[model samples]
Each structure stands twice: as structure tokens, then as C-alpha cells.
Target: GAGVSQSPSNKVTEKGKDVELRCDPISGHTALYWYRQSLGQGLEFLIYFQGNSAPDKSGLPSDRFSAERTGGSVSTLTIQRTQQEDSAVYLCASSLSKPAYNEQFFGPGTRLTVL
Candidate 1:
């Protein structure tokens, strides 16, 4: 009954701090995705989770970024040792199933600012 949603709509942090961004996907959806949009740039895929399989983390920028989905519902993206370049809008999306080309619903995103 709900669309994808992210928490802390806005986050301001120092260059070396760590931050945790949360996302809640639509109930019953089998596929979830995480993306980042930097200033003047297109959405960048960060990770993908589907059902009970291992997540696709190839899109993650570096070891500093990681995420986890619990019980196939809520997800959390953790950015360790944040950097100025990490400032951007973090978006989350969910679809009915894999082959994610299918229609997806996106969240309002969490705007992260590294000062």
C-alpha cells in the first residue's frame, strides 16, 4: 500500500564521518535498487537486491559504500568515511520482480551533503 521511501530526506555530514541511509520498498516487491545522483550527473546504479539471492553490488563506488536488505523489506546503505565527492541524492527504487527493466517506483531520495 506504500511506495518506496527513504529516511532522513536530508543529511549533512563532515568529510570523514559515516552515514546510514535507509530505504523501505513497497511491500511484496521482489526487487530493490539503490542509486546515486550527483550534481549535473545521471543516476548511478549502486546496488540491487532480489528475493533471497546475493545482492548485486558491482555498481558500488568503493569499499566505503555498502548496503543490506533485511527480510526482503527494508534496506540500509552505509557510507563509511564520507567524502565530499559523496555528496549527492541517494535514491531507492523497487519493482515487482527481477529483469528490472520492468516499471519501477522510486523514492524521494535522501540528499547527502558532505561539508
Candidate 2:
């Protein structure tokens, strides 16, 4: 599909383990975002990347969570020392411009389960 794509649609890991999730956005899209939705909770923004600017990582829950975008295209979210509380559906979205007007296409998401 021409839209966003995510890898390892599902993942399972034990507590204290580390994991990396990947996202590939539609070509030419300059803005990318990462979000996490825990069970029974609302969407939580984690990070945002726009063009060559430094990413806005204020939404990251903790130092254990991090993300990076390479060449303004592919992005990867890494979680270290995973805990059961870290389990959630991690979503990725991209748009041609910033939010508020442009529509952002989202990937199906990577389901993380920490047991």
C-alpha cells in the first residue's frame, strides 16, 4: 500500500527485555508521529518528527522509550527494560504537513505484550 506500513504487527516479550518497532511512512510525507494506546486508555503521543528538524520528544513517557527517524522517512521506536505497563498498541502516522489541517494516515500499529 502507498500508505504507512509497520513491521512485526505483533510482539510478545518478558519483562526487562528490550524491543524495537519499525514504521515506514508514505513517500514525500515530511511529518511523522508515534503514539501508544494502552488497554482502556486513550491515544498518547510519544514523539514527532518534521523534516530535518530535531524531533519533539516531549511526549515520551520515560528514558526507557525512544525513537528516531532517518532521512525523514522510516522511523523506529525502541523500548528498553520493558515492563507489563509498557504493553500497548504503538501507532505511527504521517502527513505532508503539520497537524490541524492536513490529514495524517496511520499504520495498523504494532501490538506489544510484556508478560
Candidate 3:
């Protein structure tokens, strides 16, 4: 019974490098989410995947960001041509459903640093 998990807990790269963050949600969870947390700003919802289909992707900041979920389980967030402004903690969460009464389980997050 593993909870949500993310790989490469910390990543430091140059300004132009591309980074790929991975997330594995808990088994049987159908709702997955990607979020970004900056220094002082609160968590910003990036993309949401429900049962292998993304119903909401409006939160992606720009074209440099994209994500995909396969088999309604694992998800990967890719950032192309990273910038210093993109440095932040990328968090992934999952829940049984998208209902208002459901609670999301958060992962430890992958901290990306652009130097």
C-alpha cells in the first residue's frame, strides 16, 4: 500500500535544460493532479487527470509545460527549456475521485532548481 511518490527528489540544472518529473499515484486512485509551489506563492494547480483523461489543463503556465498520464496511474510532467523563474517545488497528488467530498493525498514533491 504505497502512497503517491515522485522521483528525483531534487534536480539542479542550467537555465536552458529540460527536466522531466515523474509521479506515481496510489493504486486505485482515479484522480491525479500536478501543482507547482514557489517561494511565497501558494500551490498553483497545473494539470488534472482523471481516469487517464485530462479534463482541465488550463493551469499550465506556458507552452513550456506539459503532462500526460498513462493507464490512469502514472503521470509525467515535462518542462522544456527551463528558466530560472521555473524553479519551484513540483507536487503531485491523487484521490479516489474528483468529488468535493474527497481528499487528496500529496507526494513528497520534486524540487527543481534552475541555475
lDDT of each: 0.95, 0.94, 0.93
Query: Model 1 segments beyond 4 Å from truth?
Result: none
**lDDT at 22, model 1:** 99
Best by lDDT: 1
1-115 per-residue lDDT for model 3 (tens digits):
8999998899999999989999999999899999999999999999898885645899999999999898778999999999999999999999988646689999999999999
Candidate 2 per-residue lDDT, tens place, 1-115, comes to 4889998999999999999999999999999999999999999999999999999999999999999998779999999999999999999999987676889899999999999
Q: Name the regions of candidate 3 deviating beyond 4 angstroms.
A: none
Evaluate residue 51 in candidate 1 and report its C-alpha lDDT on the 0 to 100 scale.
Answer: 93
Quick one: ranking by TM-score, best first? 1, 2, 3
RMSD of 1: 0.8
Output candidate 2 Cα RMSD: 0.9
**After best superposition, candidate 2 residue 7: deviation in angstroms?**
0.9
| Segments in model 2 whose C-alpha atoms lie over 4 Å from true places | none
- Report the lDDT tens digits of candidate 1 across residue range 36-81: 9999999999999999999999999999999999999999999999
Model 1 gets an lDDT of 0.95
